[model samples]
Target chain A: MDVSQELADYAAKHTTQVLERSQPVQVDMGLLAAFDNTPIDPSEYSSDLDAHLLQLTLTSTQALISALFALPTTPSAEHGPVIRPPVPSTILPREKPLPKPKEPTKWERFAQAKGISHKKRDKKEWDEERQEWVARWGRDGKNKQKEEEWATPVKAGMEADQDPAATARAERKARTAKNEKQHRSNLAQAAASSSASSRRTAQQARAADLERSMLVSKSATASMGKFDKSIEGEPKSRGVKRKFDENVPKAGWKGEKEGLLGVLKSVESGLGRKEKRKGETKEGEVVVRKAVRYHDREERLKAGRGGAGGGRGRGGARGRGRK
Target chain B: MRPLTDEETKAVFEKLANFIGKNLVHLIDRDEDDAYCFRLHKDRVYYLPLSMLHLATSIARPNLVSVGTCFGKFSKSGKFKLGVTSLDWLAKYAKYKVWIKPAGELPFLYGNHVVKAHLGRITEDTPEHQGVVVYNMADVPLGFGVTARSTLDTRKLDPMGIIVFHQADVGEFLRDEDTMF
Candidate 1:
C-alpha cells in the first residue's frame, strides 16, 4: 500500500478550497508608521529547544518519522535564508513499490505452512522449582540453580535394616571423620591457647602406629617350612598328568596283545594286571560277531504285527499267518 | 524380541520341517511316519508342516530343547544332536554306539582315549564314519564324536586303538581353561 499517496488522495477528496471574488491586497500603512520592526537574533535559537512545526497537510505517520529523526534542513540553490524540505531517507523507494510488511519468524513460517496457527513461539512452560513460568527448552539462560544442584554430592538412601558390611563401613567412616575433626579441634585449640602438650600426644600416637606397622610388616612370620611336608597337606603343589609309556597299559586297560576280554575281566576285578601270564588264554579260534538283528526291518515295516499278506505280500489270505 | 510375524512363523515351521525330515526320518519305521511333533519357535503362531505325529504313538525325544535365532545353539546348529536321557533310546535307534565304563570317563574327558578297552561295552554296529554320541554305561551322553574306523575293519584291529574321534564334551562347557601341566 502507498500510505503517503493514500493519505494525499483522501485529503484531496475531503478538503474543499473556498474561492470568492478576489480583489487587490490593502496594506495598513497608518499602523506601520507607529510600530517599529525588530529583528530576532539567529544565535538565540537553541538546537535542543527548537523544533519545526509539523504541517497539517502531511500524514501522521510521515510527520512522526520526520519529527523523530529531526530531518536536516539544507539551503535551496536560489534561496539563501530559506531552508529546503528535508531529503527523504535512502529507505524510501526510487520508484513506486508496495510498503514493507512485517516478516514472520522461522517457527512462525513453519507453523503457518503446517496450518498450525495457534502455536506461540515465545510461550513459556511452568517450572515447579522457580514457582513461575520460565523457558524450559532451547537456550535456557538461567542454569545456575541446576549447576549448583549438580555440584552438590547427593546422599545415598539408607535401608531400614542396614547390612552388616554397610553398617561397618559407615561406622568406620564416622570414626575416621570424628578423629579428623578431633585432630583439627586439637590443633585449633593448641594454636589458640599456645599449648605444647597436644603436640606431645600426637607424636606418641605416631610413634605407636610406626611401631605396630613395623611389627606387622615382618616377612612370613608364620612360616610353614618348619613343619614337615606331610603335615602341610600335600605342599600345595600342582599335580602333573600321569606319565605315559605307550608300551605299558593304562590303569584299567589291558596290553595290546592281551585282548579286550583280559581288559574287561581285569576291570571287573578292579586290578591293573601287568603280566599276561595270570589270565587264561582261550585255545579256541576267535570269531568276530556281526550286529544281531532281532527282526528284519523291511518285514517289520511292512507287516510285523501279523498283518495279513506280509509273507503273502499286501494281498494274502487274512489271519492265515498267525493265530 | 518382538513376536515373529506370520511369514516369519511360516518360515520357522518350514525350517523345522526340513530339520526333522533330515534327522529323524531314517530312524523311525516306514509305517510310523508321523513319529514326533514340536512347536516351531516363532514370535507368532502359524500352521506347522508336520511330517509325523499321528503315525507314531509317542514323541522321539520327549525332552528336546528349542533353539531359534541364536546361532550355534544346540538345535539351532541345524545338525540335530539329541541329548540322551534313555539308554534304551540310544541302543534302539543309534546305528552305532561306544559304551564306556566309569573308570575311563576321566581319560575320555581329558581328551586322551576314544576306544580304550578297559572302559566298557562297545557296540559293533558302529561303522565309524559319521557323528555319534559317546555314552557311558549309565547311558548318559558324555560327549559327541565321529567314528574313526569302519565297523568291519575295526573288529580285526586292536581294541586299544582309537575307534572314535573326540569332538566336544559336556565338561568343556564348564571350564574351557587349559588343564594344569
Candidate 2:
C-alpha cells in the first residue's frame, strides 16, 4: 500500500481501538486483580502501540478541525467604516465657553487674591463704625446690614469743619478730671475720719485704764481690811510685835500707813539709813546693800502714798464708776 | 572567712559547671570524673570563663595576696608574653584556687567523667586544688572586652557551651574588693 493509505489504515485501526477502550466496559475481576498486583512486563506489549496511539490522536484532531471548518459561516453585516455619534453642538457651545467659570464670584476672587493691605484698606471704614469697622464690608450680609443700621454717617464737610475727635477727647478729659477730683475728695475725707477715730480710740483707752486702776484700788482696800482683822486676832506676844512691824511699813510694801505716827516713823527711818550709808564710804558690799535698801524704802514710801490716795478715792469713785 | 556551707558550695559548683558546659566548644565529656575540663574557642565565652574567675577571685579571695597572670600577650608584641610556665609560676605565687559543683542531682558516672575531662583540659597546667585555670580565649582575656566588642558590632558570639543567665546577685558577688587586692 502507498504511505498515505497505510497511514490512513493505521489511524483508522488505532482510533477504533481507542474508542473501544474509552467506552465503559465490564472488567474480568481475576485478570484485573492479576494486572493490578503484578508489575507490567514491558516486552510483552507491542512498541507499535505508541505509534498507533499517536496516529489515532492526530487523526481525531484533524477530523475535529475538518468538521469545524466544514460547518456554516454567517457573514457579518458590513456597516461601512465605524463612526462615533456626533456630539450635540448645543451640549458644548463654541462661543459661550461657560463664561470662564465666572472668575469665581467677586467674594471668592477677592479671597483668592493675596497680599492685600487689610489694615490700610479698613482705616476709613473703621473711623465710620469705630467698633464694627471690620464687619462693614467682609462680614456676613446680615451682620453687615446690622452694622450699617447702627453706623452713624459723618458728612465730609462737617467732619472737616469740626476737629473730628476734639469733642470725644474733651469729654474723656473732663470725665477723667472729674473722677480724679472725686477720688482726691474721698481720700481726704477718709484720712480725716480715720484720724478722728484714732484720737477717740486713744481717749477711750485712757478712760478704761483709769477705770481699771480705780477698781484695783478698791479691791486693795478690801484686802487691807482683812489684813487688819487678822493682825488683831493673833495672840498678844505674837500680835504686839506683828502689829508694830505692820504699822512700820515693810520694805517694798504697796499699801497705806493710816496714822500720822506711822508716816513720821517711816520718813525718819528712810532719812536715817540714807545719811548713814552715804557717810560710811565702803566698797561694793556697803554700796550695793545701801542702794538696795534705798530702793526698797523709796518703793515702800511711794506705795504708801499711792495707797493712801487710792483708799480715799475708792469710796467716792465706787458708786459713780459702776456703769 | 567561713567555708561555704555544703548547699552553697553545691550551688556555686552547679552554676560553674553549667557555664562551662555551655561555653566550651570541644567538650570531650561532662559530669564524668570528679574533675571536668572544657576546651574553649577563641570567642567571647572563652574570655568569659577566665574573666568570671578573675572577677570572682578579685571579689571573693580572702587575702590581698592574690595575683592575676594572663598566660598570653595582652598585645601581639612578644614583650607581653609570659610563657605558660611563667603563668604556672604566677598561679602558684597567687595560690589561686578553683572548684566546681554541678547543679540539680548528679547525672551518670559517664557524665561526671566527661565533665572532669573537660575541666582537666582547661586546668591542665595549674594544680586543680591550688590555682584557677579557666578556659578562655587567649585573644580576649576578659569576657567584658568580647561582650563589648560583640555589642558594638551587633553580633552574637554563638558560643558553644551552655549559657547561664546569671542572677543580679551574682553581680553583687563579683564586685571588686579593692581593699582585698
Candidate 3:
C-alpha cells in the first residue's frame, strides 16, 4: 500500500509542475492554425534543437486536437460527423479592384444642372374607381387603361373612323420606342466616354473584323488564295477542318446501323428544298391534268357530233393511237 | 470511301425516293446477313453490303474503283444527280412505270424523251411530273424519266408532244463510259 501511494504522489507532483510552466495552445479552427505562445527554455533548445522542436510541436498539435473535439458537432450521414467553423479573425485582401460608379444619363445630367431634385415614385398607384392598387406600367397598367376602357369620348374635331383607344395605344408605343432610342443613345455615349476598357474591347473587335474580312477577300480571289502572294509575318490561313466518321467505329455494328436508318428517315421525309418544290409541282400538275382531260373529252364529243362524217378520219387515228 | 454524311445521304435518298417512293426502307433495313450501307467515294455514292464494305475499306481511296451499285453523284454545287448505273435498283422498286412502243425503243436508248407517238402503256392514275421507270413492250426497263403529263392529259396531246422527260437512261453507260463508275 505504501509503494502504490508513493507512485500516485509522484504522478500528481509531475502533472502540476508541467501545468504551471506551460500555457494553453491558441487554436483558430477557421484557419486550422495553432500557436504555442509559451516561452522556450534556451538551455533545453540549445541542448537538442530537434528534440525541443518535436516536443513543442507535439504539445501544440495535441492542444489543437482537443480544442477541435470540444466544438459542437452534428451527425452527418455522408461525413459521419460535421462541425461548423468559426469566422476567421484575419482579414484578407480583395482579389480585384472595386467597380467604377455608373455615369449619369443625359436626362440626369440636365436635371442636376437645372437644380431639380428627383422624387421617388411607387410602382403601384391607387385606383379610386376600382378601389384597388394597380401598377403604373405593365400588367393592367394605367397607361393602357384608355385602350382597355369600354367607352371613350370622341373629340369634337376627330374623324368618325379614327379610334381614340387605338390612337392612345399608338401614342404609348411611340413613347416607348422613343425612350428605347434615347436609352440606346445614352448607352452609346457612356461607352464612348469610358475610354480605357472600351478602347481595348473596340480594338479587339476591330481585329476580329479585320481577320474575317481578310479571310473573305482571300476566298474572293479566283484561285481562292492559292495564287495570292504571301506577306511577311502573315499568319497562315486555316479553313474548317473536315471531320469524318471513324473507319471502324468504336460503338461497333449497332451505332452504324442506327445512323444509316436515321439518314433514310430524313430522305423519305424529302428534307431537301429542291425535292420539296418538286413534290409541290407534282401535286399541282395532277389537278391541272384532270381539268385538261375534261376539256379534251368535251372538245372530242363536240367535234364528233358536229362533223360526224368528217370526224371518222380523226376517230380512226385516235383508235390507232390508243395502241 | 467514307460513310456518306447526313446531308449527302438525305440528297441521295430524296432523289431515290422520287423513283422508289417509300420502298427505300428495304434498301436500309435488311436481314443481318445482308445488311447494306451507303458510302461516298470520289463524289459518287455507292451502296455496298457490310461485308463488302469491310473488304473494300482495305483498298486505298484512289485504287478502289467502286463498291456495290453506283447510285448517283453529288455535283460541285452539292446537288445529287442519279445516274444510269442505279437503273437496276430503280427498276426493281419503281412505284410507277411508263412503257414505250418498240418503235421508240431505239430513240429512248439514244437518250431522247419518249414522245406521245411512241407512248405505249403507263401505270393507271399516274400523276403528272411523277418519276416513272421507262420500260419497253417486253417489260424490259430502258431507263427512268419524269412524266411531262399525267395519263389522262396525254390523251389530248399531239403525237409529237413530249410525254416523258428523259432523266437518266441506260445509254449513259456507254455515252458517259469514261466517267461512269
Docking class of 2: incorrect
> How well is each residue in B98-168 modelled by candidate 1, as lDDT tens digits?
77778878777776657746346666544444556677888877765666775555666676887777765
Please give the lDDT score at residue A117 for candidate 1: 68
When just chain B is superposed on the true chain B, each candidate scores a TM-score of 0.48, 0.22, 0.97
On TM-score, the candidate that comes out on top is 3
Clashing pairs in 1: A309-A313, B4-B43, B34-B52, B34-B53, B101-B119
Please write out the lDDT profile of model 3 over residues A1-323, one tens digit for every residue: 36988898888777522222366778888887788787888998899898777777777777778889998999999998899989876566998999878978999999999999988899999999999999999998998999988988887999999988889999999999999999998998787778755476676789878988887887798898898887776656777999999755677657888887887776666545544554545433665656788998888778777854335566767766776
lDDT scores of the candidates, listed in order: 0.44, 0.34, 0.84
Candidate 1, position B83, lDDT: 27
Q: Model 2, stretches more than 4 Å misplaced?
A: A1-60, A69-323, B1-181
Q: List candidate 3 stretches off by more than 4 Å.
A: A1-234, A270-323
Locate the minimum summed-lDDT window of 10 residues in model 1 chain A.
A27-36
Q: What are the per-residue Cα lDDT tens digits for candidate 3 across B19-121?
A: 8888888888888898888888899998888898889879987898888988988999999999888999999999999999999999999989999999999
Model 3 interface DockQ: 0.33
Clashes of each: 5, 36, 0
Query: What lDDT tens digits, residue by residue, belong to model 1 across residues A1-323?
Result: 65998899999988543212133122222221111122323443343223311221123333344444453556677875443343443243468676555445444566899998674455566678778877643356332234334333334775645454545557656766887886676556545444455455576789777655644443235663334333332223334664423322243122322332332333334322311222222234332221123345655656746754455554455456444
Share of native interface contacts recovered by each model: 0.00, 0.00, 0.61
